[model samples]
Target: MPEDARKRARRRLSIARGHLDSIVRMLDDPEVYCVDVLRQIKAVQGALSGAGDVVLRGHLEAHVATSAGRGDSVELVEEVMEALRYR
Candidate 1:
C-alpha cells in the first residue's frame, strides 16, 4: 500500500503488458524465431514471479507482522495454512 511498493508493482505490471504486446507482435510477424518466443515467455514468467515476491514481502511485513503483534498470530497462521491447502 506504500507509494514505493505501488510504484514497483505498477512497473512490473507494465513490463508484463509489454511482454504481451511483444508476443502479439511476434505472432503477426512471420520472421520471429521460436527461441525468441520462448525467451519472451520466460521473461513474462520472471516478471510475474517478481511481482508475486513483492506482494508476499508486503503481506509479511505489514499484515502478518501486524497481526502477530496484535496477538492474532494463530488466526493469521491458520489463514496462511488454508490458503496453502487451496493452492
Candidate 2:
C-alpha cells in the first residue's frame, strides 16, 4: 500500500475504534437514546468502509494492475469479483 493511503486507513480504523468504545460506554446508560446509538454505529460503519476503500484501491494499484503482465489476469479478475460479491 502507498504510505499515505496506509496512514489514512489506519486513522480511519482508529476513529472507528473510538466510536465503538463510545457506543459501549453509552450502552451502560439506562437512558441512552436509540437514535443516538444508531448514529454512532453508522459512524463506525462509515469509518470501516473508508478503510476498506483505501485498502481496495491499494490492492488494485499494486496487484491487479500488474496481473496481465504477470500472466494471471483471469485468476486475478475472478478473485476480485468474488471479493466484491460480498462487499
Candidate 3:
C-alpha cells in the first residue's frame, strides 16, 4: 500500500473508533439526541467508505495495473467479478 493511502486509512479508522465510542456512551444516556447519534453513525459510515476507496484505489493502481501491463489481467478481472457477484 502507498504511504499516503495507509495514512488516510489509519485516520479514517481512528475517526470510526471515536464515533463508535461516542455511540456506546450515548447508548447509556437516556436523553441522548437522536440527531447526534445519527450524525455520528453517518460519520462512521463515511470514514469506512473512504477506507474502502483507499483499498480499492491501491488494488487498482498496484495489482490491476501491473497485471494489465504484464498482459495477464484475466485472473484479476475474474476475482473482481466474483466479488461483485454477491453485490
TM-score top scorer: 2
Q: Which rank order by TM-score, best down to worst?
A: 2, 3, 1
The digit string of per-residue lDDT tens for model 2 on 51-71 reads: 998888887888899998999
What would the TM-score be for candidate 2 when compared with the true structure?
Answer: 0.89
Report RMSD (Å) for each prediction in the order shown: 2.1, 1.3, 2.0
Weakest 10 consecutive residues of candidate 1 by summed lDDT: 78-87
* Per-residue lDDT of candidate 3, residues 1-87 (tens digit): 677878888888888899989998997999999999999899888888877777667766777878967988999998767745543
Candidate 1, residues 1-87, lDDT tens digits: the string is: 456676787789789889978988998989999999989989988887777667656666777878956999989888767655633
TM-score head-to-head 2 vs 3, winner: 2
The residue-level lDDT of candidate 1 at 21 comes to 88
**Candidate 3 residue runs with Cα over 4 Å from true position:** 82-87
Work out the TM-score per prediction: 0.84, 0.89, 0.84
* Candidate 1 TM-score, C-alpha based: 0.84
In order of listing, the candidates' clash counts read 0, 0, 0
